[model samples]
Target: MPDSQTLGNRTRGMGEIVDIAGKTTEIAPFGNTLAELGRERPEIVGLTADMGRYSDILPFRDAHPDRFFNVGMAEQNLVLIAAGLSKVGKIAYCTTYSVFVTRRAYDFIAIACAHSMANVKIFAGMPGLLNGYGATHQATEDLNMMRGIADLTIIDPCDATELKQVVRAVADIPGTVYVRNLRGKVPVELPADYKFELGKAKVLREGNGEIGMISTGYMSARGLDAARIVQSEGHDVGLLHVGTIKPFDKKGVIEFARRHKRLIIAENHKTTGGLASLVIEALYEAGVYMPVVKIGLADSFFECGSQEYLEKKYEVDLPRFVRAIREGV
Candidate 1:
């Protein structure tokens, strides 16, 4: 019998996976990410907690009607059902709002799923402040919540391309996966042929003078934009895009930052348990010194608004990041 600690050991590191050129993809529903997974594998099943449509699980629900289940408003039941299905040798993709899944359904995932090492991928919608619904709906601390848990794979994709590759890769990895996917059309950041592999960081552009931006999620694009803005203004700032969170590529970051003395960690997550925190810890452990700045969510829950509104208000927008870089200079 396989140990519970490694029940989902079919795949290990994301860096081990072959580079997938998901760059040809366009901005659309996360359904495409799931649909691509569905078309490729028959063992894959999808579950949702009354948010199949909102979380973009509708495509899987429609494509695999027999394999998909909607547990309806019950986050606990959602994880329970997915776990049962997974124990029976099914690869389950479960979707729900981040708040409900993280806060309301924490135990079920922590025990019923992770404790057993089930092959379940928890696709969380409205991660962080992407959802402007209300306080009760905000999932500002979901990453921090999942990061502390053991035997769970955590992913926060930067854009559509990374989203597709990450969805597929985590689906293949064993054990419970907590993925935070924001709704709507994510801008295309990577080039049309860019490659995505988990835990493998990419340097979109590097600092020519002395500054760097290591960004996660859609904010990575803002980092690139900020890099360009700073470049035009006589500052050479490099852009490092992190497609996968949690088990990050520390070696890559340390190597890059060792070349630059100034660094900025940009992300859509709050200051705690986000990109900023990880970079700081990794650098400290490696004895890498650099002035680090975080351009991401403020230490507060988001109010109602669109993604643009939330980004600008939280100082993660491109303009704000560029301005912050100027201030740093």
Candidate 2:
């Protein structure tokens, strides 16, 4: 048997998977989608903890100046205001960094929104390692924290396309929703006609029954890239995009995993209590015995660097996923 710690160290320093490739594409799908929805839904109100620009909600703010509220750097107050708006029968769409929402304003989210069942939508930016702004900003455990809240829907979209679809879908839901928002040059990976439904997972590709890759948030894009490399090397690897993290689609996961002998859960968040945990729990409950591999951040704080550099350091980059899928780790 492989020493788990030694294997972990080897995997963490696997070096650059692929060169820092691809130009940064800036598309404000979140803000754009909100703006479009706001025009159609009058009850939609936008709130920000002075992160309107960073969270990509500027388009919504600009379009509905009267309906936008900047709550400054006070994240707790932001949730409070959102809760109040929800009480008044308005759909509150709050914006802030993932750390701010999970750390600073967790109470308001749990009590003000979740407890009261407010129609508040918290759109959080800088999800997991996407920020690379050090420990203070990287929300590697946001999903873990937010998922424990009862009556709160957790969503981690895969790309700009899914981001737009999720934004529109969450607005229609009645209770509290926590969304892992992607900002600044978000990539468009999903098909144009793809529709987003709450608590449903989508299977992107059906590979040979050798390996199945399950991914959430933007990590699905990375998983796809890794799957391509695995396929090129003559391995049969499939891809499943679990966009909705909480209220996890267990039926979808079980069905997808049934088609493969080994399964890998790839996510941008930490290994524990996130997508990997959900998959493991589902598998255990169903008495499935497939070997599972997890590709995500280890139990540690992050450093400041470019997104790609941080990803490689944590062994959650494209190359690490490729290595795990190819080697059956």
Candidate 3:
């Protein structure tokens, strides 16, 4: 483990509670979230490639059975079917594994969805090491793949708070969207009222003189833990919870980066085209110079392991995260 002195100057705090609307309700995974979306938008239809129950689209299927469609297990068929539905002006939220949805249905997704700029929201399950189902199931580089598709909207939500709100926001909205979803035990990390302004990053913890760590998805939660440990050693640590990956919030990130010179970017993925790439692009465009440390899985194929094991190996775990902050700069 690295020492605190080696961790460089700190910036962010532990985290913030966003005071979500309604009494803090523990919502079900895919079911209630979809059902709520259906209630909010009449044209919002649910589709899954034989994962209605597994992906949590059962409630929507049960409630609005007329609109919901299950195109069996073929991912290609799933995309074309959803695209066909979108032609009739329906907002279709397709559910499938990240690999099956992005890789298996690549051509169909490109031509049927992106070519026409259809409104198909892909609710992808098991991003990165969320599942130990091996590389066949893990979508560690889905962002790098999908963002390459033209006119496609990429939103990798950090928690259920933004997930629920984004579901409503993309309902019937134009263009194709790929959203990474957390299935079970998605701790209410972000506050309920956490805003979902498109292309915006939230300052979960404000740093005084320490490094600012910007993160997305489950790793942001882990980053919070890392921040706590570093602060105990009397370092100022800050966190930037970024929800939108594509069409990223450049100004907001530049503003956050301007506050601190030493920066750390943490994600549950390779330091490739995910958060790290986005931050570097933003800083380059802004012509702002700063020392940035990339704390994430490196650009290599990760072997199969338990979720905890993979997290530790990837250094996105709390203890490793603290060490990365200590060593990154």
* Best model number under TM-score: 2
Candidate 2, clashing residue pairs? Answer: 25-185, 26-185
Q: Write model 1 residue lDDT over 86-184, tens digit each, in one string.
A: 999999899988888999988899999998999999988877656666567777778778877788778887767777777888877779988877454
- lDDT of every model, 2 decimals: 0.75, 0.84, 0.76
Residue 204's lDDT within candidate 2 is 84
Worst 10 residues of 3 by lDDT: 10-19
Question: On a 0 to 1 TM-score scale, where does candidate 1 land against the true structure?
Answer: 0.88
**Residue 108 C-alpha lDDT in model 1:** 90
lDDT of 3 by residue, 1-329 (tens): 32222112221111111222222324445567788778878878899998776676788888899988888999999998889888998888999878678888888888899889998889987788775656677788888888788878788877777777777777745788888876543456676567886767888888785688888886786677678778868777888988878768888888899888688888767789888988998898889888988877777776666565566667766676776677765
Tens-digit lDDT string for candidate 2 (207-271) = 98888999998888878777777676798778999988878999999989988999999988899
Candidate 2: residue 51 lDDT (0-100): 89
TM-score of 3: 0.88
- lDDT (0-100) at residue 222 of candidate 1? 59
TM-score of each: 0.88, 0.92, 0.88
